[model samples]
Target chain A: MDFQPTEERRMLADMIGKFIQNDYPMKARLTAGTSALGYCPEAYSKMAQLGLIGALFDEEVGGFGGSGFDIATVFTELGKGLVVEPLNDTAMTSGYILAHTDQLELVEQIILGQKRVALGLIENGADYDWSAPETLAHQTGSGWQLSGMKTCMKFAHGADALIVSAQTQSAPGISLFLIEAAAAGLSEHSFQTVDGGNACEITLHNTPAQLLGAEGAAYPLIDAAAARATLAVCAEALGVMERIKDMTIDYMRTRKQFGSVLGKFQALQHRVAQMLLEIEQAQSAVINAANDLQSPTDERNRAISAAKYSIGRIGCAVAEEAIQLHGGIGMTWEYDLGHFAKRLVMIDHEWGDQDFHLIRFSES
Target chain B: MDLNFTEADQAFRQEVIEFLNAELPADISRRVHADLHVSKEDTEFWHAVLHKRGWLTFNWPKSFGGVGWSPVQQFIFEEECAAAGAPRILPFGLKMLAPVLMAFGSKEQQEHWLPRMCDGTDWWCQGYSEPGSGSDLASLKTTAVKQGDHYVINGQKTWTTLGQHANMIFCLVRTNSECKPQAGISFILVDLATPGIEMRPIRTLDGGQEVNEVFFTDVRVPASNLVGEENKGWTYAKYLLAHERNGIANVGISGQKLARLKRLSLSQKRRGKPLADDPLFAARLARLEIELRNLETTNLRVLDEFSKGAGPGPESSMLKIIGSELEQNFDDLTRRALGRQAQAHMPEVFEPGYNGPQVAPQDMANQSAAYFNKRKVSIYGGSNEIQKNIITKMILGL
Candidate 1:
């Protein structure tokens, strides 16, 4: 029944929260988001120096605090500031895959922010299915040769390596392969994401790849990593929703029309109350999913799907409602709430959207 | 009692379609339909094409160089233009300012400006919303002090759509601070090239610089540019707002977007089947279609009243609210149908001669940005909340 975090996790949250408050103003975040690398490499390196990235990994792999609550605590703060770093791809998802494959050295490097690794699982038509990737890997004498197109590889433009899932010619199931970013036969078209992050459409033409784990057995691990990533975004969405709600209330309290502040009106007050209620519900969902991350597969999947679905649905409502309440200012680029709203809606577009998870929840 | 278009109206629609097919540039139509950027040249070219055909000023009386089409004919033309992906005739001059000029401006002003508007000599942008005043526009603080033959305008106006491309701006400025906020305001036209007037682009959430903030540092304008009596701007502003509210519904654009959305959904796959076939997605599209249908009917009803010589009343507020919400709904569904593919933000794809790779769906490179951009529909032009408030007071008699 205890809902509070441990003292260590609370300290972790406080440190990250303070860092965001001090170094990550909206203007700075905007600059970083549109920077050459699509994020502040210096700030990321600083976060690593602060031991923030290491907190997402287990001690066996690199550092302490690999629990779901650890991921939630770190990402919720990042989401509050709308930080555009590739932590979810480089550390959370690819780090999990590397750690599970006993690649402790690379995992340690990622934990220290020395290497950035992006996960390439989604294909053009695959939607969310990681079990039967269209990307193909052929067995070679020295290593493996991969050929496929991976779309929407988040932060792929800046990654040192990519942990890509592909179907093997010699096997019937999906497998994980680590490919260098500069490998031959690899081409990428990088573009900024709608949420101010960067992504690339990676086309592999017999690109060299090193298999990490057993062939034809990458599905379960891929599914697990996806669940973890999904939970991270859901937690992040909870953070985004909270910020939107707060900004909206602040707007209502100050913006005057008809000789009175908008908040004084009962109609607006009720909608703001509804936004608060939805945000609280989203918070509970994140907590529940975080707690269930280490549980059995079905239970974990169910909780994650429910949470993600709630976030995907409720996050949009809150984002749209916040903009409507604030009017033109909410739609402006200079205003901070608009960015939060953009991140919130685009979060649903990422990991998996509401429709994707609704189907998953029903099946789970 | 018959709901279908009359035979003559159908023939008129066919004529409009043929005219668009012949005159509308293929590139412009393709770009418009794809939601890509149409250059100022393209817009002006199309505006000139329509003006030459005497169809650009369809809303005006024939005596004022208008084609003077009936309401049904206007509806048919607009629908056909939307379906054919014609560049939207910029509403600032042709719709908003022209009506006010014809209604309140002196014969000299109308004679000078109306022809320039039709001839594409001047690109006009509205300067109504200020940084301090959006929903409550009367609270604007931009001042217009009369100085002999010219008025020295000094203040800022934000959310001026497409002002960067404009040579002229119609603004609401404070003429007298002694009176009530609404009473002291005056609507005045100013040449944007006037000294001390600086227009800085205000980037929207979609990373587009379509709107601007115009700062007036003692910019001077001719006092004769005032549309009507001094300090009577509120009356003219309200009149123009009500007059233009019916078009804010944008029923034709929604229909066009819904069609594009359906095609996108069908092209996108989910588990070996078209995303459109998925029951959940199907239900959403179906619901959007139903709502659009209801809105179309309501809009036609409004136009029906207009044909009988009735001005757009407060019921236009209902159309604004529902229409903007429906268009936003189409955006939501379009993005949803793309899933993570919509995350691709290659805005340059909309640029002419952009041969870059499309990481997402073809012609949908900006779906996410468009979704983010369309949030302005509910926020601007007297925000939907303000429309609701108007409905509450004026229509519901609350």
Candidate 2:
């Protein structure tokens, strides 16, 4: 069977690559990294103008009806720029939830860039376990009352709304609810993540929330969202890996010690080769996962878990090796190598760590 | 892109699986599964069985006594053989030399060796590396001086894998001294039993005499045994090496090893639970499995390119590098799973018939040995470092 990207997908990838090169340079990312939101709002608005945020949904949902390949293309570009935005969490995850639900109005708002949605699924003590949420929601007078703490909610301060997963009091399963950012009885404390983006601890005290979809039906949706988010992060990690590799290689070429370029040493060369190999492996997994998104249930779950496990492990390894290879410069924040490394480390732990996904994969 | 096999390909895969299930001996499969060294007789037996089915050269052209299966079918066959634990058919003849003969050998050369190679009449060994030549293979000093009708071959080839069991050796030797190093070389076929030829076994750390040091003290060989024109042997040798490196990728073998590792890990208890339950170990295993999957797909892509009439190129170098690393990684994981059992240093463990001391199962005992043995995979077949250079120059144009 063919594994090469389609001509259309290739064209999309090229376009995104060009966009990152021209619009979002490393300096721009560095500047944005110093901001409160850790990303350029103006640049993000431009991305929305290009229809990237809603790339994977149908036309009726105000999206391009683009395939997962399209989303991958956009994310790869975002990664190349080391763009510190909540697109991965907000657009990919929250947007996925909105697209799948019957709430066309909210989906339109997210698609048109009028409203931002951040995902708040991970609860206190729920160590990256997406399915087993500790947040609880009870039937209220009109709809639902949510009462739980969702920790490490990306971009909560920037979002207009939040998609929260909570256990239903009346049922034995988890349900997803959408609540306004300034809803009464909802309090948030935002802090900087390792990558310098905002992740919030949202405390919901009987917060008025509306069901995003049928109760207990959000598990599959959440799983799908998590998979998409993981793949998106992998695309970003691949970008960071490529950048780090290039920087390391360039440094070796110039940083000669013993009468020759450090790159000439076989030991260093093999290390770089190993890094490249891991990146390629991660790339293959991400692409395979993107393709598998269209497959049937069983295959999709297996492929996604396989992708997550591969990317998480390889991504972290590459980042660590990249830092090691760069010597002292890699550790300095001024050098920008630490930026990608920090982002990679954060992404590696997010959605699911390598071990978390590995267990899921083996069990599957 | 889709990974689904076509209906016809699926049927062909089923046929090959059935054949392997029916014809491959259970004891041989068991030995392979356990990573126990299979005897020469077992290899020859399976080769003969495949030869009888006209599938000995599974990837060769029908013109050369091969089954002439499509690339996908060949992949399926290999996947089946590996999954069924069929002993790996030694590739010196079928995979390495046969292709060289097909490409650069004279019609007479093809007529002489092709049939014999298929029928298990001649077991072949490589004579490329010398003590000095490893990754700098073109620096080889083995020489064959041409006289009137024959070449007087001298010098030595080290690390000749399975040379002790070989009846024939395809060698690279210096034929001209005045020219450049690579230019002066030639590819020649030699009878290992010829006069003045000697093979001394080199016992590896695994305590197995699988490799040999072959010496030629003025061994005479017919000049007609040269595969191609004199002084062009380097080209032919290079051609043969591309195939050798590709075969060394051994995706099917890696897949088989990974499956076996999974089973072994599941059987071993760690902290009152299977080793597979250990998240870190499971994660590493999963990561390796995923990498192996990617390698498998890339290999299939390479095979598809080959079926379209392309020869092995720099992409093959990528395969060799990744494949060898993945193999070594799998072995490392298997060793790690063995843990304390892996530290057992009884040299007698790998002997032909020596059962001594209370030990882990034979399989677990062999894990460390396998790991140590595989350390050379990245070093041999042109070290992964050299492969990166090839990729840098040929592919990335660095």
Docking class of 2: incorrect
- DockQ, structure candidate 2: 0.01
State which candidate has the highest DockQ: 1
What lDDT does candidate 1 reach at residue B123?
A: 98
Residue lDDT tens for model 2, B1-398: 77788999988988888898799987788678767667899999999998888788778877776677887787778788888989888888888889988998999999989989877789999998886565567878889998889999999997888888899999999988897888999999999989999998775534456778899999999989988788898787667667753345678888888888888777865545677988788888999999998988888888778879887677778888898889878876775565333433333445556554323445454554455455567766676767888888988988
Candidate 1, residues B88-207, lDDT tens digits: the string is: 889999889998999999999998999999999999999998866888888989999999999999999988988888999999999999979999999899998899999998777887
Q: Candidate 1 chain B: minimum summed lDDT over ten consecutive residues — where?
A: B30-39
The root-mean-square deviation over C-alpha atoms between each candidate and the true structure, in angstroms, is: 1.8, 19.0
Spell out the clash pairs found in candidate 2: B186-B233, B187-B233
Docking class of 1: medium
lDDT, candidate 2, at B365: 48
